[model samples]
Target chain A: MLELVTTDRGSDAGNSETAVTFERLLDLISRGDREAFSELYDRTAPRVLGLVKRVLVDHAQSEEVAQEVFLEIWRTASRFESQRGSAMSWILTMSHRRAVDRVRSSQSGHDRDERIGLRDIEPDYDEVSETVEIRIEHERVKRAMAQLTALQREAISLAYYGGYSHSEIAGILSIPVGTVKTRLRDGMIRLRDELGVTS
Target chain B: MNDRHDDDDPRLSTGAYSLDAVSPDEAEAFERATDASESLREETDGLVETAGLLGLAITPVTPSERMKAELMAKLATTAQLPRQEPVAAVPDASAEPESAAPAAPTPVETPAPDARTASTAPRAESRARSRWFARPATLVAGIAAAAALFVGGGVVGTAVSGGFGTSSVTDASAAGLAEITAAEDSQRSTVPVEGGGTATLVWSNTLGRSAIVVDGLTPLPDGKVYEAWYIDAEGAAPAGTFTASGEGTSWHVLAGAMNPGDAIGVTVEPAGGSTTPTTDPIIVGQTA
Candidate 1:
């Protein structure tokens, strides 16, 4: 089968650091805080929207999942503890999971041509030299991803973006369950080290 | 199969974890540990970075402003729905108790245009519409399928064995499949490709139609969708368009007999159906 690529519209100009702060507004949101929610939505929605577009690849599904992600944040603000992760992470995670669900729900496994690997897909490396405000931050994240081993890289990606669980990843890769575990363990440590995320 | 990773949230590896590779006990164990520890959460963050990587792979396209508007309209309707309570008629402000609370007048222009939406708003309670989720239809505004036929059921680069891999094949080729007149009665004529899934095309002369059923296929990404193609000896031509009907499976039928070719193959193309297939055939067969 030939490669079928689905292009997106925006870049992650917003750095992970600022994007990470979207959670502050969640508190206000639970209290039905209006201004905070607006601020939160402005900073986070673009990336969330982008994330949805990357996965579901359908405009309608992207929009639908976006709305649901926001609404979910509105309704479940209390469950969001900053200790869990960044606000951007929470929101983007919501968008990804929901998009995956919709994608999974719609297709019944006949065709599997969409092999959109992150490294294999985008055109940013050449454009990395381009002047963008978020370039430094974006590069930092990319560099962090590079530090991990290939197994760590592939394992984390499949589990995270592929939306497959441990068992699923194991089945796809044909690796033993133990290898999946340690790789994921080491992958997270490497990611945290990359993010400079120290508790 | 009841291993530590299976019983714990061992960050989703691609291979062994692609499907129900584990036993019930193993999956249950994994779920329990996933819930009990922060392993899943940490891995979740890494997943975002991975998602970021996936985002990078997408060729960027400028979105239309109209798409944004359409979505905003959709949000306004959905937003107003939860808060709306059906009423017999559009009511006036006369029935409210005036107090320390600000004077609530009957809204001249209801936020949502739908009748059901207007009726659903807080009856006489009339809370200010300034709530973040409750923006004026203006800010509340936003905006957000096709089947075409082409040659070969595109399924190139699909996740055949890699745990965390993706394919460039569009799901569209599944739609344009011409009915195979010969295989109508076979209960299991469809076959699975070495690529980790199965696909089948059914033909029915009475209905003058053909339909393709794909199972175990991987799901697609957003914005970029897949289109189906019908193959003819002349070359690949647009047959129709199809979105994922559900699961890792899609069922799409041709409008008429796909007599365009002596052989049929599947490939991945752009969102709109391609003039010809650019990918390899995920599955193929000749029409009887």
Candidate 2:
């Protein structure tokens, strides 16, 4: 079931070359190297745009936010700290935050609630053009996600992919806010453990 | 699984925060709480990294070709922030102090307005009039300083000379520096030292951690060192002490958790270090 909307991006865990290249590119970008910024944008734009589109589901707005994300990356390249996390994580985390912010700020409660009402149906993943590397990661994440209980999976999906707040998720799932928080937390911890993510 | 009422458990919110599932206010509160607890912050970072992996689960989408063209064109006008050394290298006598300091103080230097602001300025005048638009350069400098704080994780190099063991103190302070800078509510202030250098203080009120980076100050003579202090209404408390290297740059993680409204000050003291500051502060950066 998870495979329906699952496909991986080019870089994933254990790919040290991509990580090093990102860090190196950021280092150069910080020094005003336009070529490095261009390269960095080319490498990460698809994932950035993909993640934004997943949360927003609006093509034009998704593109706008993706552009803003790239501009932010360009302006704040010096802020990338290798010690805290990977360059890719930093970029994607920023992208996700921006997308969520847009969703929360732009949409009214009624509109968001209406969207949440229809959240159970999964979005189709484009499988025709994906690479083998992407499929491997998709399967790995799908397997890990499969381990989550239905409630946990539902809570995580609404919060992450749907950009819904816990209270809104509570409203959608008809559970108490506290219960929603617990489910989200437990679900993430389980996912982290299953994926073998280490701090 | 039991439906645990874990709203009060701050740790639970780490997941929501990582997923950007909480409201901005909740995220702020979580960040404040996480700032105070290193373990919580570490848990949050781990979860955030895990959530980032979830981003890769979707199929890739190629943006319109014009997007890249527009971005490339925009890049021609945008000014990239200056690079900062993670750890201040051995002071070079030939290097200009002004050049060594990350981000100059002038607000006029950061030309090229942000693309979003530029695009929306005419239509959304109210929205475009944010603090960022008013003083873009200052905002730029603050961001640069914050970024410097992150890369400056090892700014604790001088702590070794201050009598703390080299490896352990440096490692602990580096981690602390990273935590404070990464905190959502972290604040930074830069003040010019009396002697010619500048001291940039980065602190998080919730985390109670602060560090100062001093640049361009004249290297102190033998038996004299710079002492840091946390000053509030009642009195001053000694933070730590360290001498400037030959190049006149020093980074020290102030000792102990900071109290609310405490201001960070640095004064020169004797080599062994003083229990109390013996002279006037050469520089004071308010963290309140």
Highest TM-score against the true fold, candidate: 2
lDDT of 1 by residue, B1-288 (tens): 467634343454322222222343454565555576675645544444344433333323333332232222122212221221344343532233211111111122443323432343333112212211233242212210111222123333432232111232322222123112222221112433324454554444444445556653443433233445555435555556555533433555554355522233444456665665554444444333
lDDT string, candidate 2, A73-181, tens digits: 8767877777666677788898898888888887643454466456542434435537666566667677888899989988888888888888888888888888888
Candidate 1 ranges beyond 4 A from true positions: A1-21, A34-36, A108-131, B1-288
Local accuracy of candidate 2 as per-residue lDDT tens digits, B15-62: 888899888767778988998999998888878878877887677688
Interface RMSD of each: 13.7, 8.1
Worst 10 residues of 2 chain A by lDDT: A1-10
The structural similarity of chain B in model 2 to the true chain B, as TM-score, is: 0.44
For residue A126, model 2's alpha carbon misses the true position, in angstroms, by: 8.7
TM-score of 2: 0.54
